[model samples]
Target: MTTSLVRIGLATALLLGSIGAAAAHAHLKASTPAAGTTISAAPAELRLGFSEGVNLKFTGVVVTGPAGVVATSTAAMAPGDDKTLVVPVAGPLAPGAYKVEWHALATDGHKTDGSYSFTLKP
Candidate 1:
């Protein structure tokens, strides 16, 4: 009986460990323009903050404006912050809805992607 209880406890511990690890994947925490925000002026860059550190080589952002496919530079991590992604917008954005599509590869090897839209007020 004792041996069976010990085995059960070990199994439960392993299961919990796996669950914790699975929850560690990078998740969008916040942004500069902020999700669903309406700004009076065009933002020079898009900033994304994640729950975990990300790998920029496998991470990127795609911006689409009224004209579609607004050019953006490759995403790079903040100078000393691995959890923040900085993407430079190539030019001024027009007054309209803009969508930012982002993909990130967490340091733990997990991949996550999400998109959000913000309106540019005229």
Candidate 2:
């Protein structure tokens, strides 16, 4: 009975391990300027890279200043690379600390959201 229980436990462990690996969700491998990086000047665009292809329409970002939201552009999909999505940040974002909140839905159907703040040096 003890040996039988041990075998069942091992099998269950293996099954769970395989399922966990297969159920892994898409990840954000890297982003230009990085998530916590601060720039002296306003960036021309916001670039985010992912581990796998994602739906750009569902990938959205909102930049908010001390006053309120600064950008109104909807989520814009990047061409050529399905794993990358970019938002065009037009005009100049005044010098100050800004908060960027973003959400992305991977092709695997998992949704993730994150927020970061950066200071605009004078």
Candidate 3:
């Protein structure tokens, strides 16, 4: 009876583990021109890293500053890296606070979104 119960418990644990893995969503892991830091010069491109591989077709970023919406080129995944999103700035940014809003869909079909802020110094 004890052996049977142990076998059942192991089976349950394996099932739950697989479910948790399948439900994983992409989360922001890091960034260049990173969150909350002030930089002297604007970066030509923004790089956002995620906890899991994301679908580039379903991921995007919107940046806003004191002037209003900033222009950015289309976003793309870094070469050989499915977990990093790279966005190119269309022009130099004026010194001010900026917010980056992003949304991503994991390869597994889970969606996630979040925002962060940074500043440029004169």
Candidate 4:
């Protein structure tokens, strides 16, 4: 009976570990002009940090301001970093509420996307 219980416990532990690993998708861990910030000057670029490494080809960000869609430069991985995505503002950001929507494909082949907002002071 003791040996049987030990096997069951080991198996349960292994199963739980695998489940945790399987749930590890690239989630948005952080961002620049960070969620809900109020800034005096428009940021030249936007930066996002993820929980895992991301594929630059499959990562993107769309920003919109009070006027409408704010154009952004092509998305790229931060220099020397695989977990940070950077998008440049095409021009000076106007004062207003800006929303940034992002999508990411992690190295693990999982895709995740999310959005946040920041207020630019006049």
Candidate 5:
């Protein structure tokens, strides 16, 4: 009887602990260009600022250039002391609004997704 009671208590604690952890608050705070800012020229790089620290290894930026998705070599950098990252622009963007679709997983394992656009000056 005692062993069964102990097992129930342990299971209850584990379930509660998992629920609390999964409810962690983590989200993207802001971003440069404000999601729809038009630039006179193509920026050398793209940057993003988040509300919390994130795992850079699981993060990436997919830039849909004039034609299609631009190729990139560098992987997104993980969060450091600064909750911002400087994502490398795959290549020179054409004169038009380019879309940037980004996704990042916070330290708590919650994923955030967002998209932004910038004009390369026609």
Candidate 6:
């Protein structure tokens, strides 16, 4: 009886822990022209993949490059993919280093933000 109770307690604890983890805020999982990579050609748009679905209305990214603030269109969720945020670049990016700052609101109502940098080959 005691062994059975111990097993039940462990099982309950594991279940509760997993539930808590599932509620975590969205996290950046991947990106186009990926972090710390050098690309010879400019990307017309930026694609950001998150760990979970995000609310498009509450998510965005700000890109800054060698010349300063880069122009980008309003962010949108990739069609049929709520976990990916797509932002269009207004024009070509100059050769140099660029930093992308992003903030996201998960569908679950949790918020998260982060930044990454990449270099453009001349």
**Top candidate when judged by lDDT against the true structure:** 3
lDDT of 1 by residue, 13-95 (tens): 99987986788899999998999999998999999999999999998888898999998877689999999999998887889
How many residue pairs clash per model?
Answer: 0, 0, 0, 0, 1, 0
Best by TM-score: 1
**What are the lDDT figures for the candidates, one per model?**
0.91, 0.74, 0.94, 0.89, 0.72, 0.93
Arrange candidates by lDDT, highest first: which order? 3, 6, 1, 4, 2, 5
Which of the predicted structures, 2 or 3, would earn the higher lDDT when compared with the native?
3
Q: Give the per-residue lDDT digits (tens) of candidate 3, residues 1-122.
A: 69999999999999987896776889999999999999999899999999999999999999999889999998999999999999999988999999999999999788999999999997
Cα displacement (angstroms), candidate 3, residue 105, comes to: 0.2
Give the true-structure RMSD of model 2.
5.3
Angstrom error at residue 99, model 6: 0.2
Pairs in clash, predicted candidate 2: none
Q: Model 4 over residues 16-59: C-alpha lDDT tens digits? A: 87886687678888888889889998899999999989899998
Candidate with more favorable, higher TM-score: 2 or 6: 6
* Ranking 4 against 6 by lDDT, winner: 6
* RMSD (Å) of each candidate, 1 decimal: 3.4, 5.3, 4.5, 4.7, 3.3, 5.0
User: For every model shown, what is its TM-score relative to the native structure?
Assistant: 0.84, 0.72, 0.83, 0.81, 0.72, 0.82
lDDT of 6: 0.93
- Check candidate 4 and list the clashing pairs: none
Predicted candidate 5 versus true structure: per-residue lDDT over 20-89, tens digit per residue: 5666534556665557677786676777777777677877688886778866557654445446766776
Candidate 3 residue pairs in clash (backbone atoms < 3 Å): none
Q: Candidate 6, after superposition: displacement of residue 86 in Å?
A: 0.6
